[model samples]
Each structure stands twice: as structure tokens, then as C-alpha cells.
Target: MERIAIIGCGGSGKSTIAKQLGLTLDLPVTHLDAVYYDENWKPLPQEEFAAQQEKLVAGERWLIEGNYASTLPIRLAAADTVIFLDLPAATCLWGILQRRWRYRGGQHHKDGVFDRITWNFVRYIIGYRKQMRPKVTALTAQHAPHARLLTFTSRRQANAFLSEVTTSA
Candidate 1:
């Protein structure tokens, strides 16, 4: 509950759940998108990004959200809890569309970056379950053996867990 890693596909509501959990648990929140991308949508170097993540995880408490699977092992090793949002691809596609419309011509509310919804992004979301999920699952099992792992197959389940956590808190 203290150190949490919220990993999922682009439109899988990782930022949303991280924010809610951060509020409920009184922990600081870090969006990996914000950490990796600048306001102009420029990316930080991979080494720099990993270095930044290293510093964040060294803290005693935080809720870090993103699906940068390459560096997942770092956070997984440090987190006390890991939440994997395994929502359907269609739902994730719809989420991206909704997010584009909601934040039209402006910075995204969650990450404060103006991201484009390109066809490649859509394809990535669609292929995530088949491509990325297995790797993420394996990484979690291998790297975060002692961490409490929670996988939600749908948004309803994720919200329900949030509600239960909030109420208990």
C-alpha cells in the first residue's frame, strides 16, 4: 500500500487509478508519461529516464503509473503493491478517443502533455493484450515476488477495488 506500481496499456486508466489511490493513501503520484515526455512531447533519454525512476523508487512511498515495461523490473523490485489493469482493447481504444476529445487542443489532464492519437498508437493498444500482457505478467512474477499483485480484467473490477480500498482507508 505504501509503494505502488500501476502498469497498463496507454488508455487503460493507469493514471486515473493512480491518482485516486494516491489521494486515498496520501502518497505522492508520478506519471511516467510526465517523467519521460516534455511539454513539447519530446522524450527523455532512456538512461535519464531510468535514472529518474531510480530516484523515485528510493523514496519510502509513492504511486508510479505507466507501462514502460523495459524499466518495469526496477519499479517492481521496489513496489510493495502492483496493479495491472487488463482491460479489453476495445475499451482502451474508446478511452483514447474519449481522451483525445476531452483534451482537444490542450495538454492532457493527467499527464500535462499534448499527445497525438495516431494510428500507430491505436494499433499498439489493440495489440497490447497479445503482445505486452504476457511479458508484463512474467516480469511481475519474476521481479516482484513479495509484492501484492492485483490484476483487474475490467474497469468495473478496478473501480470496485478502489472503492474497497478507499472505504477501508
Candidate 2:
């Protein structure tokens, strides 16, 4: 329960869940979005992103939320558990729509300055994940060989799973 990885498609509530988990556990949570996306919605160089993440993850306990496979293995190494949000494509889009709606209306989704860019960035959710699924599944198998992998196809299940995690899950 010391470290955890929340893996899922874009707009799949990975960051939100990780934030809540951090509050529940009172441990530091790393939102890879913040690390990967700089001001103006520009992406940090791979080397630079890796370096920044490498430094942040050196901590004894951390909860990393992201699906950037480039350096997922490194973070997964120290993660005691891996939570995968396995919602359907339509469901993912719905969540993204709701999230973007909130962002557009200045309700949620953190920074509002990047709300306009989110539309373009999110167009690849399905296609990208089609290619990313194999890698994600492989890593899930590789990292937590015997650890629990929770798949939620519905909001009910996802929320229930969170409610069930009483401790450092």
C-alpha cells in the first residue's frame, strides 16, 4: 500500500482518483499531467519529463496517476498496487465529455487555460488506446504479477472500488 499506479485512458478519472486517494492516505500524489504538460499546454521533452518524474518518484511512498508508458515501468516498480479503469470506449468518451464540460464551464478539470486544447488532445482516446492496450495489459501483468487489478466498466463499480479501499490501496 506504500505506492500505487492508476492507469487508464485519457479522461478516465485517473487523476481524480489519485487525488482522492492521496487525501485519504495523506500521502503525496503525482499527477503526471502536471509533470508532462507545461504552461500553454506544451509537452515537456521526454528526457526532461523523465528527469522530473524520476526525481519526484524517488520518494518512499507515492501514488502516480498516468498512462504514459514511456516511463510507467519505473514507477510501477515501486507501486504496491495497480488500478486500471477499464470502462468502455463510449463510457470513456462520456466521462471525457463531462470532464471537458466542467472544464469549459470553469467548474472542474483543474486548469481552465488549457480547456480549449483539451478537445484536440482528447480526439485520440480510442485510437491511441487501441494501440496502447497491449502495452498497458502487458505492464499490468509485469509490474504487479500477483497484485490486484480492478476493472470498472461503470461509474458505480469505480466508485464502489474506491469506497472499498479503506487503507493504502
For model 2, the stretches where C-alpha displacement exceeds 4 angstroms are 105-123, 166-169
Steric clash pairs (candidate 1): none
Per-residue CA lDDT of candidate 2, range 31-129, in tens?
777777766567999999888877876888888888889888777666677888876667777777777676663323253122333555566676655
The TM-score, computed over Cα atoms with residue i paired to residue i, of candidate 1 is 0.95
User: Which numbered prediction scores highest in TM-score against the true structure?
Assistant: 1
Per-residue error at 81 for model 2, in Å? 0.9
Best by lDDT: 1
RMSD of each: 1.4, 3.1
Q: How accurate is candidate 1 locally (lDDT)?
A: 0.89
